[model samples]
Target: MNLLKRFAVPVACAITALAMTACSSSKDERRTPTPLTQFKPAINVERIWKADVGKAGRYLFSPIAVGDAVFAAGAGGTVAKIDGKTGKVVWRTRLHTDLTAGVGSDGTLTAVGATRGGVYVLDSNGKLLWKSNVAGEVVSPPLIGNGLVVVRTIDGQISAFGAETGELKWVYHNRAEPLNLRVSAGMTFAADAAVLAGFPGGGLAAINLKTGDDYWQAPVSFPKGVTEMERINDVTGAPALVGAETCAVTFQGRVGCFDANTGRPIWQKPFSSTSGVAQDNSTVVAPDDWSVITAFGADDGRQLWRNDKLKNRSLSVPLLFGPSVVLGDYQGYVHFLSRDDGSFVARVKTDGSAITAAPVLAGDTLVVQTSGGDLFGFRPR
Candidate 1:
């Protein structure tokens, strides 16, 4: 089957919530998210600045922060570089093509992926450098590192391009599953040597930056049920690496920590989540499908605590900052939870749109871009 035909039917149903199951169920049985309660704010959450990029459309495109700047793109084809401290627009340009994911940069070079299977690279000043074609929908921001721009597409293909010349370097495809989430597990650099990515089949592979060769391919989770939906053990979120241990979660499988260099598993725990994992120095935090936030020991994968207050809320990837872990929900509210006990510490409202993308913590300030294209910078007072 062609890529579009293979995904068209399932994607039509699943694209509503990006990772939601489109199974037939009664209206009453549909899990309505919990009503948020009024609580005294424990910490002062202040919005430093706000700006609009454009409409975000269907995909959860996010801004990438590098050093003193934040690069963001909207589905309406607008891309801008914002001043990190002031939220001022440094430079803005229109791609004239619908963007699926973007704003990956290495401070000097910036890149964004189009829904129609291409990548556009820009300089720090927002000038178009080069545009290159790729294989599938670029649902995640390309990873810019080590003179190579790496992109993971929706059809289980990872391709690299020359950062300077826009030449095709290499491509790697993971085992494609018919039933997988429409979202992409954003890629990252591991130990500054390999590009790490998670794919639809609960697989994690590291490709060497220099040679584009596979360093290691490890199974973070596995399929284990009767129906395809039940067996959908896709690694939907980006992997979290802390020191030598790397952790990733799957849709219907396990969350495991592995050795960064070799593909040896250190510890494995059964968990299900579409949102990616987050880590600080002590704990690895993840939100399961029902929006339950759980914290695990960084070294052992031992369950430390679980917070079910945000059940069925469709939380974003957890952000570890200060003494609390922060999460955004379907109703455009950002909730801060105590890292020590999973208690709610602070809550703030965005534009009342779903904050589907994870909050980026740059330095001590927290940056959140809502699905509605409202970019905000928050700091605790």
Candidate 2:
């Protein structure tokens, strides 16, 4: 796909991040570090392919790759699937009410939580599998394991259902003070069992995928404070397992990694400590809270290097694009920096809108969604 470069393009997009901000954890202990103040220097980026598909999933809630195609949802319950390489919509459907981008077993199947408190499914070719009303407005994406389906509502309720029959399994209540956790659910690693669904008040519980039984339970995080923001945390995004360490982000602006077996804190940093970290074969790389990309020893959370060139409003979970660590800023720009020294290498001037969502790395195409509903997929020029 040949493309044109649109630098400083005057696009009417809201970088305010109100939509993205709402998806963030309610607790922000310290101000987020600005990327400009870091010690790194300028990097280079080139434009590849830019098109207006008019669908953006928003920050932590967005467009994702499910096998060969990427799925994005819009305001009017509009869901579209784009060819991973051609930026073409292979399938588009309007589900009446607004729906969230789905996540499930493989990229082949999609399960989305709708604002109207419904759970919907789609097959690999973008065909509707089923739609069932669970009980509450589905906020968190559904979890699949052990032949059971788990989902949570915006108000912090967890419901387990039979994945095959869509039959109600069991329901659990998570009564957390609603200070403003834009999201309401989370999950952690369970040995050979199912994914543990994390709730509020530091409630850590796991539902057996086979029988929906409460396997093991623990707290997501221990909060200590007198203020409203201090006491609340909304878990967003799927938890990343760093080897034996299980990592998760809370709405309170805290990143914690715990022992997958013991539920102990392996390492913890604030949202400002290192908002997002991406793991590879060898490195535990994280975006510094202030203005740097730091690689830590995954074995013990030891800091290796601080590449200051990759800082921004909200540090996204960096995607390894080619030999570069790809991170998008709040200004809607895609940056490809050297993974070793954090040196700026290539930068592609995107729509200049805040790219709150993580970039999708397909077989070859680089897919990202901006705040203004523009789906941009790029390739090396």
Candidate 3:
């Protein structure tokens, strides 16, 4: 049997289409990326340091920041903890197998998933604690908290293992869809005891982090199109949580915020994104599939402003910094747009490779990892 027919084409194809807009033979002009316009720099961005991790081979790997250290992994099995301010390697560990997902830590224990269906947990000093097997392919970074290492597999299984012993605690199965995007949709810790995650078919659920039981499940979007390709509506990233509200975005679906406790929709808008949403107390920002960044009112889901200058640039999830909406593009350029007006304020280029993961704010520095495995820390002046 043809594997593509059985598993459906991964959303990576769509990402490739968006990234390779310059090479597309299609006559549609919208497929072309928007040219960067000249803008006066409003803020000075200075590179603090750069470090090389191993490359991410056809997979998305993100670095997690805990306190002053950033834990990062690469597909070639290198996991390292770097100082957030100095960019110096605190400790580096190399696993025996390739890593498919990784770099979750609580400052004491670090967890990552291997390509061969297992989770590896390490102590704060980079010593390998234990490894445990899971049911399916792990692509989302494991959540290490509450004395448990929670992992979500591509087959819709969320398993919690003992953080120290590596013993399985419980497993929660999300309703599987006929076709789902094989992308890195991660889980977030919710309310100290629950794990907030998005599932295939646009579901947002809060699972008990210790027992793997469901607290609440809400729908972010419903599949509507006729074709299987058109009907693929998977929640594409880690849901953003603030106070009692949690927000998520789905592919070919909607962007909505829901009450974290009751799973009731606060407000939803017709939007499609291959990434997640970032929000502050007042504004929620996300990039649509074409890389048009839009900001919405966090309280009522009203459209505030939009900047489409980076369309078809394959933007990552927006990082809401102090006064700017920060994001990276396919060309490895990190952009800072004014949060109030969506205007470009500053831009900096990397090693000319795609930055698939969101730019993380480590301490006061902005950290970004490119697909080519270069991690750079920047500070605003």
Candidate 4:
């Protein structure tokens, strides 16, 4: 699911009506995006590399970093392998099809999903291996592991294919809700053998990587509100895994941690987020629906600190890079906040377009893909 595209229409309408409130004598004022406040830069960030692929407007394909090459897929089905150090294009290929989500890989093989219910696979050299048709439109990237390519679709269907021959291994189906968020559910590997997934109805399940049999299925968040929209509890983003603790956040629900192997609750915390959770050694950080970044203790889910400086800015997911937590906003601004106290450390401007995808990290360099098709790499100076 691409939440930025899904929310852009209403956000634009609010922006257009802002001037009337600003000039009115009445006590009616609309809350717009908070203006970026000026501050001394605490850390020096430099743009070390940049590139342009096809337009990424309104699409949600995130770049994947593998080894020394970073594989990026654009919204228009252009895939490129760029060198991590020099930002040189090693190989580029066009699928001749519109892509919905993709750029997932297992080093030697890569896969992307099409808008027309198909998935395209490519080898390391950018050669097309095989294309397989599935039952539903895939909004999330495929998870490649254990010689299988596993993909989850918008219709709550999960399928596995043989990585080498594109053979269909097995498929699992779950009952979907009538009203759910228009975002995607990312899949992760538990112990490198079990396929872990968070569903649109706030259900978490684990399946066998090879057999596709059900290992375990449990509800992470239950619908609680009275209205249907308020009760929408989709797990939109990817779940974070640290050691054996797997943490996930729900859109209108709670954030909790579960044991990866047994699905037992370690700690359950009341928090709402469309973005997923990111963790370091001691803290787990997440952005709530109002763009407030909050930090909690990883061990006990204790509240550490909260930063509301970027409220209403429509923030992307927080990324923990080195000593700072980085986030991108709707106005194409990259912000750096201290991991210790949730204080602003630095900020930089991009192409002035919304950053629809999460910021990706490759070694010491930070990479961000914007909706305006600008791919940038930054490093702390």
Clashes of each: 0, 13, 0, 2
Q: Residue-wise lDDT of candidate 4 within 354-380, one digit each (tens)?
A: 775678776667888777777788888
Tens digits of per-residue lDDT for model 1, 157-211: 8888999989998888787677777775787676447777888879988777777
lDDT of 2 by residue, 210-278 (tens): 555565555555666787556655444455554455555554455555555456666665542223456
lDDT of each: 0.80, 0.57, 0.84, 0.76
Candidate 1 achieves a global lDDT of 0.80
Ranking of all candidate structures by their lDDT, best first: 3, 1, 4, 2
lDDT per residue (tens digit) for residues 299-342 in model 3: 99999999989988888888999999999987899999999899
All candidates: TM-score: 0.93, 0.75, 0.93, 0.90
What lDDT score goes with residue 112 in model 4? 90
Winner on TM-score (3 vs 4): 3
Stretch of 10 with least lDDT, candidate 1: 2-11
- Whichever of 1 and 4 has more TM-score, that candidate is 1
**Candidate 4, TM-score vs. the true structure?**
0.90
Q: After superposition, how far is residue 193 of candidate 2 from its true place, in Å?
A: 3.2
- Model 4 clashing residue pairs (backbone): 1-183, 1-184
